[model samples]
Target: MTVVLLLCIITSQLTVVLSSAGNFWTYKGSLGADHWHLDYPHCGGIRQSPIDLQTRDVVVDQTYLSPLVFSGYDRVSNLFFRLENNGHTVQVGLNDKTMMISGGGLGATFVAEQFHFHWGAVDERGSEHSVNGRHFPMEMHIVHFNKKYGNFSSSVGKVDGLAVLGFFFEIGRFNEHFQEIIDHFGEIQFKNQHININSIPMIDLMPARLTNYYRYHGSLTTPPCFESVTWTIFNETIEIAEEQLVEFRTTIFENDKSDGGVFMDISDDYRPVQCMFRRRLYASHPSLKYDMASPRENGNDGVSNQPTRLLFSMFLVCIWCILPFFSF
Candidate 1:
């Protein structure tokens, strides 16, 4: 009888130890980004994301770059989305439809999966991808998977299998596009709370200029930092009132408040910019001449008038051929 009781006690102890070892990740402390690589190997990969987009360092290859094409971003005819507070951020899952992206220089078509945001406690900094090391109030990422790969799960770990569109938002005019989302925040204040929303025009959530953007090859900012994504960041920014931005902070990072775990705020939940590793950053618009001595703000008038060296050489050859023919 004594031996049987001891065996039962040992089994219970081992079960508790194994269960605690598989705890999910959080934004701070033990399970934070710094230690994510310990459990998820890809988190320490070479080509990570949320990189700084230095205007001068980026190569302006307008020849290969093209305007981003969206098929059914409006989705007026569909009521297919559910909002969820997934501990890290507020995510909106979309139902499969005509909503997809094909162009914008993407080699293949990618269907929308979901969208989420990264924000800060204060307006000084929040965005993941910074322009010239400047952070915005918040950032939105629309995630998509290459249709060639079938679904998001199968597309992971493959090259060019994902496309993520990023947009920066600053405090300005009230964004009517975000009102519906803000009003529903109360229902999802805790983690894992999800509710269906009648309608959402996903395109309206993006910046006005879809053609003017930056592109690069990088990994997902969150674990397991899979390096299968093609990133598209718009030069134009969207706007949201300060009041609406604050509502995002109310969401908790803890899965359950009654579990006696420390409560962490979801603000400043963005990852820091990773190393570029000499990777080529391409822009769709004309190149901006680098002053080197003085950095200039990349305002609306930043496009260069000077033609590319390759284009100029081709023009010269055409002129020479025409001159020789006329002389003969």
Candidate 2:
């Protein structure tokens, strides 16, 4: 019995060490965005993403920021999509080669790779990038890689390698197209879980108009925070029912079932707005205006001010380091 207990203790200790080490970054706690820079130097770089788009400072560029041309986005295919819960967010892989985008000042054609969402715990806030410091309930990012680089992985580090189309969500009537996605969430409720979705035209998930938008050079919001994305945030917001928003907040878990079956909700999977520095934010249309009188203007900019729990994390590390010494 003593031998069995010792073996069990060692196994538990190893599990704790591996879990802590493997998950080096997370949305909150000591390993959150504020501490990501310690491991990924680019997270601290000047060109980081999810900036508060202050409309008052935007530069109107209707000339070069022409209307984006989307090809094959509306085409319904027989190819199924893989929807997954990657622990960070729910992502849908769009492997179709036909789906492509160009124009809107993009020098080369870009092909769709995948799309994912970032949402808050409630309907009031969730979006990564806010307009005039006002956050929407949710945000969807359709990621595309520049065709010049050949594939998504190859284009990740290139300056002009990726273009991400961002759309905000507001509470309103039910969205049938969005429902198609939500219906599959049950299959991917746990981290690393995935399901195959029937083919649906990608256009169904987009806003009605794409002419009005904000553009800027930015980085991926996630860790290894590569400063390679050309961001296009739409002026129009997608409407979904309040219940649907709740479904998103409640349905997914960041932890797998095998990890003690702990229920950790995957909401608020977004990084706070980074400093814009000297970067220029551009608008496709001159008429796209924002309300300067937004509540966020009063200084509740939605950026988290919570101090990093570094000391606590170090204490846990020390415990893990000493666990092996306790064994025979």
Overlapping backbone residue pairs in candidate 2 total 0
Candidate 2 wrongly placed segments (more than 4 Å): 1-23, 289-291, 294-328
Provide the lDDT at 87 for model 1: 83
Query: lDDT by residue for model 2 over 268-302, one digit each (tens)?
Result: 99999887766899998877755465346347674
- Candidate-wise lDDT, in order: 0.79, 0.86
Q: Model 1: number of clashes?
A: 0
Clash number for each model = 0, 0
Instruction: Please provide TM-scores, in order, for all candidate models, with all chains considered together.
Output: 0.80, 0.82
Error of 1 at 192 (Å): 0.8
- Name the runs in model 1 displaced over 4 angstroms: 1-23, 251-253, 260-263, 287-328
